[model samples]
Target: MDFRKLLLVDDEEGVRRFLGLSLMDLGYEVKTASNGREALAVFEEFQPNIVFTDIKMPVMDGIELLRIIKEKSPDTEVVMITGHGDLDLAIESLKFDASDFITKPINNDVLEVSLERARERFTMKCALREHTENLERLVEEKTSRIVELERQNAACQVVNGLSSALESASREVETGSGLFNELPCLVSIHNRYLEIVAHNTLFEERLGNHVGDNSFDIYSDRTSPGNACPVQRTFQTGKGQRSRETFLGKDGEEIPVTVYTAPIPNKDGEIELVLDISVDMSEVTRLKDELFATRYKYQRLFDEAPCYITVQDADLAIVEANRLFKRDFGEVEGHFCFEAYKHRSEPCEGCLVDKTLLDGEARQRETVVTTLSGERKHMLVQSAPLHDASGRVIQAMELSTDITEIRRLQDHLTSLGIMLGSMSHGVKGMLTSLDGGIYRLESGLKKGDAERVDAATKTLKAMIGRVKKMVLDILYYAKSRELETEAVDAAAFLRETAAVGAAKAASAGVEFVEDVPEGLGEIKADTAALSAALVNFLENGVDACEGRGADGGGRLSLSARREGDNLVVTIADNGMGMDRETREKIFTLFFSSKGKRGTGIGLFISNQTIEQHGGAIAVDSAPHKGTTFTITLPRGPAR
Candidate 1:
């Protein structure tokens, strides 16, 4: 046992000493204090577990000290020592959380008993706290386990529902009965004595007339009467077996019925009963006759349908195709879709068929297919998820429509717009050149100088060349010709385009820089077309930078690099950028921010040319900040 430190506080020194010695002899470490004040000091220094205090003290009363000690350490116990007749003060101490009260003449046995009771109560409190903590932990663990089990049970139910539906369908087909019949079929068995041991509805309906008769009498025509019957054979196999039999009706007509027998197990695992079901096949005979008569009509509807229709199983194997589908793409039943149509050995990445089955929802997708003959076609496909009776998706019905012609029409319209815009721009540039040359010629005629006449003649020839080039561009845009591709170093292309605009940038007092990386990989594109596009972008940048003063003059940066499988070229300018409304319409035909001074064909033509090269162009700009036009083209040498 561990010894607890005990403090004895009293105004009388002799009484304090006596109690201290008694507690020390009782296996406690005891300390004595003369008054309540001294006792509190000793209590702090000694760190005692229990305090024994007298009621009356010189500076502080025992009741006050007990209250202070309890406030400081609520777990510590305090015993009040009072005079023989001071019962009121003892009661007061107890109300102030004193553990126990003892009179002036303290009984040693009562003190020991009170201390033991306090120790026992504290031990029980600790044990209860620990037990409560453990119970809470266990409850939380069991709750989580229950949630997991419920999830598993729900999954199992879905699988079991499908299994049961399939089994029922098989049974209906084997017994040759209507699945929706009210009282479908039943089976029964009897022992050698011919008692009514077991019988199904079908057996009862057929053999009720011979009831109360022996089993051997009804089946006496069969050999080996003592051996296993057909029903017994079914029991041994635990599966249903069917046999054909003819019954003579009351009017002398013969009726044919198919009988099926299965085994029923008892508690001891013995097959004590047999189940029989009889099905009438007269309706089936009529259905076969009707199917042959209408086959031609159904075939006509299947072949003439407008939609590109095909049937596929869960594995996406083609099971059937309509006439239109077979005509466009060769007969592809039983072959994988990617192999037959896409001419690939693998399924298309991000296949929508798999998604439709997993979610059991109708899905639509647009895909580009490269046919076996190297023809690329864009197709829009819609697939309907097909589910079995139990709601499990088993297959998909797909309808694909060719959208290649539509895309071509859209591209043609875009090209037409670009051609008209470019024509306006070229005409405007020519008119500006003519006006400048005529003014210079008129001034030279006043001076009578041959040099000015020669300069004017050269200017006229350049204007004619410009007009011819513009006509050629219009012709190229109108004709549907395959792209002529060649290898061109992108870095050199950017530098040449930037150099053409550098003189103009200097005259306008604007700074221009080429940041393209040297030895940047080449790209496959029409060299003349690509050069024209880059020059247009550079001219636009220089024009935007023109009016801003030398100190506030704009800056232009041209950069080119390879990003992934693309060659990216960026032309950026720190100039007066357009507002949101103007930027939105900048690429539209006849839309220009420069009013009468701009034909707006520069960016629009650039957009078309990049798109033709299988590339994209995007403009990022904000008012008063700057503008950046980025062109991304597929990376490879021109073919």
Candidate 2:
């Protein structure tokens, strides 16, 4: 039914002619050759869709012809014709891409069925090839469309970027123009040729027709050009200029003008324009005249002021000094007050200047200074930072009052109060140790055993040691004993203290770590006093850890290092820390966290000793997190 031509190959002429006639009757154009060689020549000339040949021939065989036909036209189908004795040979030809085989005397029904099958196969192959070509064309079109879309997207992005840039530039120009119009002073802009290009409302109202012309022609009617016009000077030098002048307004009244002119640069870093601003100075001039008439009164009050006053910039450079400041601390100009009077290159350890600037408020601090003349002065210094209109700190004013004699009297009174408050606790601790020793001795005498007596003797010695330490703390607080200062190794002292507390920490199920750097150089101080202060801090850490371990275990850390010229000792514990109010009051006398177990004099005594050494103690703590007490002691003795 396909009307497709077929190739029937065999050596028999009779079979070929019959098949060719049969295909022609079936409405297919047909051709035939007797042997395989003739069939190949006829096949090429006819370009038939099917071929019929004999199995055995003179020059070429059916199998050889089958191979050649397929090589030339793969779409053509081959049907081999064979005799009864050559059936095996025809069957073997199927291996050569043969379509089908027939017997010697071909059955007309079977032969026609084979031809129809070959035509159906050829029709399917042509349909598949056409489908493949269509798919290839579709793929090419889709790929081209994707490339075009990508190119368009890139072009749109460039346009969008340019649009955003133009919008931003327009906004900036509008903001700058608005600010120039709203300013209270007279403002004008001039191009490189010295022609006025823009004038604000205030400038036009005051000067009338005089503006928009050269500044020299407008202001030089009564005075020389250089003396009257500051804008001309700024244009000539390409630098900023400021001066004062008297100008007659439109109402025929004279007004003082303080003019300031500056150059505006172009893209090439060259001054291509100038901006001039003029401020009316009538009120300022009137105030100055009034102050000039009362100068004597101000001079008298300045010299008789009680407090020393000095003006300094943010860098602490002195700009002005009052009479009292010069008289008391020597003339201090072009030098910082601390370096001039205290003779130090840097500020004191706990500087108040930083605090004032950070909080933007007045700060007060009390410090001691040993002047160049060997005079020790204690002063209460109060300073306030001065801010510009933009809220930027530019300068500071400092006032210092001599408080040496006053602080001495206050310290004497404070010492008396501390002694009275601590007397009961101090006396009780000593008596308790003394009583324990007496009781142990009495018990040993009654037992009458040599071993018991020896053990009791050691107990008595330990009790006596406790009593001696309490007496020393009391005497030190009262300043009743002279300090025995010496150079002591800080690292060695820290190791010894950690060893004593490590056992206690282990008993409480807490880990204790000692991180002391070895070979830390010695610091000049009273060895016994320094050791006592460090031990007190360690004891507090141990107590805090024990309290925290009442519920679960925590950690205790003791570390020491020589940081620059100071020796730093830190004791930290993971325990219930104090609140802000409690931390602030910890150094005060009679303040205790351990109600009955603590005498409250440990930290108080430590605070007094640290201050006497010209050192500092600070505590950083947070509730439920922990507390760390850092003690910093100077490497040298106090002045």
Candidate 3:
């Protein structure tokens, strides 16, 4: 039936049932798994062409499965299923070569699009494989033919060169010259009667002087024209003759040799004499070995090139990949270059290969690509056209050089410069405010005004607090410190942090509410860091409420509870909320909604602290509405 095989994996049975049915309806022969562990077992047995797996599952996660599957079968397409809050994980799966991702409450249109893309990729891969196999076979055939031709040409050159030299020597001999004595190989001249009328010194030394002897008489096989030697055959056929023969040497040994003969014609085009040349068999064998070794050396150099090299067809399908490319990206030949190198659904825009193929011109560009191990690399990719015998572009060769470390160092230096610039302004403003507070305090004390002195004391205390917080934030950003974790009652910790937030809210005329319940379970985290991070969120909530003004019914609340193996905390405020742009940048370093009143370091530090404890924060807010931050932390400390 040509049925397409698909494996559907999820921890939930209900999801598997519904998704499997949907897949079957779409013409797939589907198998289901409850988790990644089971999915792998099913995968090995079923060998499905496509797999749909949930990102979060028991035993093993989809990201791990994706990596394993890609290692085992780079051609298999894996699509990740995830929840709305797992967008980051979904994006991560793509780095491991996931075909595509679908969120919870999967849309039919999206699923269909993902499936179609998978099918297209699979089909293209199959076609590429077939084409590559055929090309390799053709190349092997052509190589064998070329080697044989070269060997023949080498032997023919030796014979023709010697024959031509011997012909010249014969003319010299006719002129009573002694040039015939210097020829390298066994050479002689024979007449129509097959008589060796003349012989070179090499022939006389090896086969003994045979002038006036029948040419066939020197050969171990033939002794007369009835059973002709190469010399007799050349005269009989009126053409050149080449054959293997055994020569009777002076020592009476049967020496194997290659005999070549060419008839020497007179001016009237009548054959008057035949030139003979014989090379030792061992010499021919050496020439063949040299040809083979030279070819092998070239092949080794191609395979061991430092950068990743691939030969691609006009379609951009990889026809060949070098050893290093195969080692890192798996056996990716017969796949599209974009899919294998960049893990993309289609060719990259302004692809170098495409441009090179079109114009027969070399091209180069810098691009970022993800490796099979999920590491991102910056590569300098260059492509050159490969032409056929007719000078038409048939394929393109692409070379990629890894420049990841270089790019990383450059990015780090740029970020450091920007951070220092931002910190200087914030520190300067805080120092200016501290100086103003000191001047106010001195004036109030010198005037002996009790009310003015009290006001000055409060201003000085507030300014000092801000300055102290700014210093701590700078220190935290300057270096990373390990967490010293300990277990603490979640309810008690939440209440203690809430008391401080509540007092601050009261002073600002903003109502504060606490929903911390007893027995909320224990959480393992760095107590000081976790407390400060949570307090930062609460204080921000209080500020939001105070900014909304008292008449706006400003209110802030703190709540915490245990959810499964994690502690879930919520800090919400019915106050001045934020737009999408502000919300997105809230946790970014040096990004703040408040202008002069904020240093833009509190939320950034809080976010870092939460992440260090293996926690996640989700915020939901709308302009003029309200804001809620949902923080989820594991019950146990990070491993």
Candidate 4:
């Protein structure tokens, strides 16, 4: 079978049975043992590639088993299973070369991760061993061939001896063996006089057969006695020398190179010939530059991204933010995202980043956010998880794109569509009333009836007023005009506005109460717009009270006063009050709760006008309870 072999050892019988089955399910040929001693017996019989043993066990513990296994088969991967209390023992197993350790009540995912790691290590060791054996055999064959071919020369004899020693101590060379295989490395032997005695094939090809030449002559900077090359340094120090040096190539070009030199000692323990190796660094330098440029490019892209990008840790703290984020939100690193982005004391409800961190799934949400400048914007927020090599989510990235303009445009288009649909029926009804009034007036005039003519005149006048109000509302919704603000006496402005509402309320049999006081404050406002806006609210109160009719005990109140630097105006009504849903959408464009009598534009324009005067409006109401609107307007221009 193409399955891996695993040995499971634990003192408990249940652990052995359960864990053995789990290992088998993971594509491992599993065998169980009740103790470390029993595990050793099975280890010899099964020769498992991996051994998972509990740290605390009878007869032999996992640490002892690990030591024994490493001594017998160093390539075998041993993983320790220990309780939380036996953590120190598990750590000690690492000293014995155990692959990994897992605590008791082991998680299956953790177990699989450990197994995969052990499998990788086992495969690497096997591959490395095979490579070493092949390399040694190749060196031996090449050495024999060189010995036979160059047997006639004395210098060749010395070169052959040095080559044999180099092959045997290749692992002790300390430099990467792969570099030697990939690059044309210059290797040569220098005598005690710093004169090159022999050289390798690449050395002869690159440095031009420098057998009897001075070793320092090959280096551009070490041509003088004041500066010695790597070979001369090795001879003087009686140790290995490694440094960056420049070599003069055979083509008369300066080549950047890394040089390594080792001293070959004589039988008397004295330094004799020095073996030198130099590697051309042209390709390596280019690769290094390319890697650096790639990293820099990615970092630049991350910093200069158009949208606001923030990397948050598992705790939802902002670890890194892009340039735009820092510029808008201010250096927000180490702060919670909600605090920095939304100005909330805690995390946002159903946060997209939190969802991504939880399930490692990408998510998106549309939200409204306020900037430091107090400008509110609509944002499309997206989140994605950042993972480590083991596929565990380490952090999450949140990207927010500003969609405020898009939402505004959509609202405008939606308002137009709803306006046309809603106003059509109301306009049709008003026109029909106007037509009836005209017919009555014509008939009364022809018959010369004074009472009928007077009644028809009153009806025609009322119908014309309704038609005029509807047209104004349509014009205001179609194009908003800039405010022509001026200083106005709060008491005078509010009283005049309340008088109109009071007459309407009295006509409908509802009480109108006013509380305007003299010398309240001068409010900086667009006089016409603010007056019209306040009158709109007062009229709404009258209409709300009128909904209850004469017997409903309806009442409407308008009050104005000065509170610090603001003028506070309140309009209240005891009528068919609104629920929470109606209150929330009352300010939204083209949203009306009234079935047919309402145009829905009065309150929207009123709210906008109040805001334009740097004022705020708050509404408090509940089902069956009366509605109260408190408007706070600045006494001066907005701060």
Specify the highest-lDDT model's number.
Answer: 3
**Candidate 2 C-alpha error for residue 331, in Å:** 15
- Name the lDDT value of residue 197 in candidate 3: 85
lDDT of 1 by residue, 74-154 (tens): 766788888867898889788998878877677889878877876665466556778999999999999989998998787
Better of 1 and 2 by TM-score: 1
lDDT of 4 at 98: 91
Question: What lDDT is reached at residue 69 by model 4?
Answer: 91
Off by over 4 Å in 1: 1-476, 480-483, 488-490, 507-509, 521-525, 549-552, 561-567, 588-590, 596-599, 611-618, 632-634, 637-639
**lDDT of prediction 3:** 0.85
Candidate lDDT (C-alpha), each: 0.71, 0.73, 0.85, 0.84
CA error at residue 605 for candidate 1, angstroms: 3.5
After superposition, the stretches of candidate 3 with alpha carbons farther than 4 Å from their true spots are: 1-307, 313-317, 323-349, 357-361, 368-379, 385-395, 402-423, 445-454, 478-486, 492-515, 548-555, 622-626, 637-639
Superposition-based RMSD of candidate 1 using all C-alpha atoms, in angstroms? 22.1
Give lDDT: candidate 2, residue 623: 81
By summed lDDT, the worst window of 10 consecutive residues in model 1 runs over 214-223
Residues 1-639, model 2: lDDT tens digits = 244555555555566677668767778766666678877877877787777666777789888988998889887888777777987788788888878887767787987888877778778877888889999999999999999999878756654554354333323323346665577777776666666666667666876655456665434243445454666677778788988776666676776878788766554446666677778687778888878767867766656778777777766778877787777667788898668756789876665665666677889988776654677889898988879999987777788888988998898788668655666665576577567767767777887766767766776675565556555665666664445787778787678778877766775677888999988888788777767777777777777776665447678888888789988888898878889998998887667787634556678888877877778999999887888999898887683
Q: Each prediction's TM-score against the native?
A: 0.35, 0.33, 0.53, 0.51
The C-alpha RMSD in Å for every predicted model, in order, reads 22.1, 26.1, 37.3, 24.1
Task: Arrange candidates, best lDDT first.
Answer: 3, 4, 2, 1
